[model samples]
Target: MRWMQRTWIGSTITLALTMLFLTGCPKRPDVVETVPRPMAPQGEVGMPTPPPLPKVAIPEEKSPTEVAAQPSEAKPTTEAGAVPEAKIAEAEVKPEPSAEGKAAAEPELALKDIYFDYDQSAIREDSKKQLNENIEWLRKNLAGKVTIEGHCDERGSSEYNLALGERRARATRDYLTAAGIGADRISTISFGKERPFALGHDESAWKWNRRAHFTPSAK
Candidate 1:
């Protein structure tokens, strides 16, 4: 009976130790559930794909009509067939006259005027020489008619001066006619003291005012 009681006590102590160890020790944590990530589809797999092509561009085809319609570039030719640049420049340059041509341009005859003396009663002898030269020019030209315009010194009444001017003009016309100019080719007019060549009442002014002037008129 003692042995059995000892065995029973020992069993009871082991059972109590086991119960204590289980109560004091902590339990391990539970593992959480996880979902796997989806994978990317590969090109060689059951995926849709684009059509394959060559890397280089294909030459476009042209119709025969379009090719024939295009203009061709001009071909370079020799100087014999084409005008030279030097020739073109020469054409653009103007011709310069020779020295002989310039010398020949001098005038043969020139128009000249005559001056009279101060308030003279008649034309002076010096004026006769000038009138002779004028007659020579008239005979040479032979195309134009002449008119003698007589003027008086600004000293007398206008009406009296006008009559005096007319006499002077007629005298000049008679002289021209005697000098071999045709009477039909000459005419006369008179302007009195009312139209003075110079305004000052001086010798110099009177010389300019008392004059018979000649002007050529076309037929």
Candidate 2:
């Protein structure tokens, strides 16, 4: 009987000790269940994709003939007070010389003759006046050239008259050269007894024949 009682108390104590140890230990965390979200609608995951735009067709290029058929841009018209371009061009271009201008360009009068004493090459005092008049004309018309034609009376021999006439022409030319006329501008020529100014053998005829005449040349 005493042994039975001691076993029972010892067993009771052991069971109580086991219960206290289990109570002192830490508890484990509780487990939670996870649920998956419903899948998004087919096109709504991010931004909805825009529907494809309808394609537009480009027109073909026109032919050159079709382009030419189009109306041209209008040109500006001249104002009422404005002058035409053609008239302005004509006005800018100078007109040719008139009849009056042509007439004025030519020399108006001829030079006077210079008479000399019979068979003499010396220029007379009266002839000097004529030469002065010629000089004035020459100065005005600088381009003019002259030939000094010396003549003789029929009384002298042809050869002698020719030689004398040349002397007279040379003397006349020398006088002109001394008076500022260029030597190149004055030319001398002798028309002997073969060509006489007056037909008769009298002093009047000889006086007229023994003279120096001025003839203009173009050169």
Candidate 3:
């Protein structure tokens, strides 16, 4: 009986030990190794890299000779072609008058001297006809001015002849004025008996001396 009790105690002890070992030592779970994913190539996910800028071709600078070689646009011209400067100057120049023009420009024949009666300042009929012809000439040549020279015979005293001569000249001027000639165009001068048409002291010379001469002004 003692042995049986001992064997039973031994079997119980061994079984209890085995159960404790199984419970205390649990089986380990499977271990998984973590690998870090390669970092995405720089700038793939967050901010993307900008593409490179395109290149622009620049033109080369041209030389002076190349620029000059280019054809220039023609200038616009008028319908009437441009006249030469010399030709324009020649056209502006006035041509000299011909010989015929010069001859035509010559002054007309002088008016005939008017004879006055002795000791009289009044104009005679014959003298009036001559004066009218002179007036016509003056009218045609408006630019001409005349001086009337009065003369007297040597019969009177020097002072008296001078007075007579002046009276004669005034009478001639008045006649010209009344005949429509401008007074400003006519001037008077008394020669008295100093200058005579004829040098002789006879009546023929005296008749010629008592005259009014018409002299055109040079100016």
Candidate 2 lDDT over residue span 39-87, tens digit each: 6665896856778789999898899999999999999999999999999
Cα lDDT for residue 116, candidate 2 = 80
Candidate 1: tens digits of C-alpha lDDT, residues 1-219: 999999999999999999999989988889888978665555657666656776998899889999999899888776567888888899999687665564335212222234555444466678788778778767876775777777888787898778777777777777778988898888888887877878888777887788777776653
Please give the distance, in angstroms, between residue 126's alpha carbon in candidate 1 and its true position after superposition: 1.4
In candidate 1, how many Å is residue 68 off? 44
User: Which candidate would rank higher by lDDT, 1 or 2?
Assistant: 2
State the local distance difference test value for candidate 2: 0.85
Per-model TM against the reference: 0.47, 0.51, 0.51
Model 3 misplaced stretches (Cα beyond 4 Å): 1-108
> Which pairs of residues collide in model 2?
none
lDDT of 3 by residue, 94-123 (tens): 799776575346543445578888899899
The Cα local distance difference test for each model comes to 0.73, 0.85, 0.86
Candidate 2 steric clashes: 0
Off by over 4 Å in 2: 1-109
- Residue 171 of model 3 has an lDDT of 94
